[model samples]
Target: MSIAKRPNPLFRNLNAKIAALPMIATTLVVFLGCSIWTVIYSFSKSRALPVNEFVGFAQYERLFRTSRWLISLENIVIYGVLSLLISFVIGFILAALIDQKIRFEDTFRTIYLYPFALSFIVTGIVWQWILNPSLGIQETVRSWGFENFTFDLIANRGTVLYALLIAGIWQGTGFVMVLMLAGIRGVDREIWNAARIDGIPVWKTYLFVIVPMMRGVMVTTLVIVAAGIVKLYDLVVAMTQGGPGIASEVPAKYVYDFMFARANVGQALAASTVMLTTVLIILIPWVYLEYGKKKAQR
Candidate 1:
């Protein structure tokens, strides 16, 4: 009698799966595993290092009550909202304007996008010098017989965040512009022809038809920019160092300070968990609507 053959259990792309095993293992062990550990330790009373003393929400209570943490929360909210709105608008506008077949298109695109090649630290330092009251914009303007010019927002408590906002936009909007331009280019030429045939104005076409069709690109951009806003630390450190008396503090900086400077690992982990939860809350619905439904449909 002939023996029955054993069937292969793995997927057809066995080689590809094997190749990805290292990365898969890394993701599970490093990212997911560390995240779970951090969340667990956030409830502890650890100091100097992670421990298991079990604090029972006491760390979180102190976190919320702390003035620095509260200020950081408020600053991040303001920064996130304003940065998203301004960057989206400016980027889309730049992309659209460049799409008009303007002269030296490549040159203009290079200039617009070059800033994105620089790191946030570099951008922050450069802008810090440019915005410095004694040696930068204000000084130059004053020398130009405009001594009454008082453009010292970076040094002022009430307006330091906006100064950070300006530097952020200058550095990031270029990348957004490039993304928006790609999305705009991906639009069907047939749609534009039809819009023109119907005597629709170019502005109206973009505002009504083009933008709505680029929903995927817009959502992707929003997610990326929002993530950067949430994890804002380097730029603030390089530029303001959360200065002007904690006016420009942000959550990521707070976590860093607590973890390293103060040696309060438990409190740092707690604050980090809060930040992670905030991000998940914003992302989960979007991910479900965007990708989950498609998987279900498939």
Candidate 2:
């Protein structure tokens, strides 16, 4: 008698695969297809609409030479770098504080995390009001006897990006704190006890022992924050409107204006392609290294 043959691997999950075909196809068509189209058209010179005739890197050359684009890049770099450093440091501190099992722990966490629940638009609007020189902090302070005090960070081009940075950090730190708290809680209890037995300071325990174990969670948080930084559009729109002379403009805003308002499709797509390339450059190596390590471990 012949033995029964094994089922084909491709057919093992055939039903599930069939059910997922629509989603897979949608992603391939809607996202991947559009992205490929954008990249291809970026090489062509176009206005008011995309032109099929290729002009090579002319769009990219103009994009780099544009003063507004250069200013936007500088603003994003400063905002991104500071946001990364400040959020990580403050989030870790807040998480460590909460992990001490302080009284009213739940209340404290809720208060700290409340801001994160608000959308970026709301956050930017709220901060814009608070930073308004004539009506907000400066007015309030002047009324209270500091008449000569000036707080116009949002109006001045030099300090406007930092104003955005402050709002960004305020709205984001709570989420970062929660992620860090989860990582802290996931650390082994035995390790905490061991540190205590060795008479290690609380801060030392966190700095040396607990943090090293939370590397995975930290990496995940960093990736999320970096992605948000790359797409810095809504908050800038809601708050500054790329004002103070486009000092607060970011890449996403640049792409939006070029595509819709200016109708320069070629330059718009070129900027988008550059943004996509930057993201892939950052993420591909991270994915390879992280997953490669996991596969080796297994």
Report the Cα RMSD per candidate.
Answer: 2.2, 2.6
TM-score, cand. 2: 0.94
Ten contiguous residues with the weakest lDDT in model 1: 1-10
Please provide, for model 2 over 1-298, each residue's C-alpha lDDT reduced to its tens digit, 9 standing for 90 to 100.
2223877777787899999999999899988999999999999988889878999999999999999888888888889889999999999999999988799999999998998989989999999999999899989999999989998999998999988998999999999999999999998899988998999998999999988999999988988898788899989999999989888899999999999999888888999998888778768877997999999999
Task: Say which candidate scores most in lDDT.
Answer: 1
Looking at model 2, the pairs that clash are none
Task: State TM-scores per candidate.
Answer: 0.94, 0.94
Across 1-298, the per-residue lDDT of candidate 1 in tens digits comes to 2223543556556799999999999999988998999999999989899886897899999999999999999999999999999999999999999999899999999998998898889989999999999999999999999879999989998999999999999989998999999999999999999999999999999999999999999998988889878999999999999999899999999999999999999889999999999899878878888888699899
* Whole-model lDDT, model 1: 0.93
Q: Model 2, 58: alpha-carbon shift in Å?
A: 1.1
lDDT of 2 at 157: 86
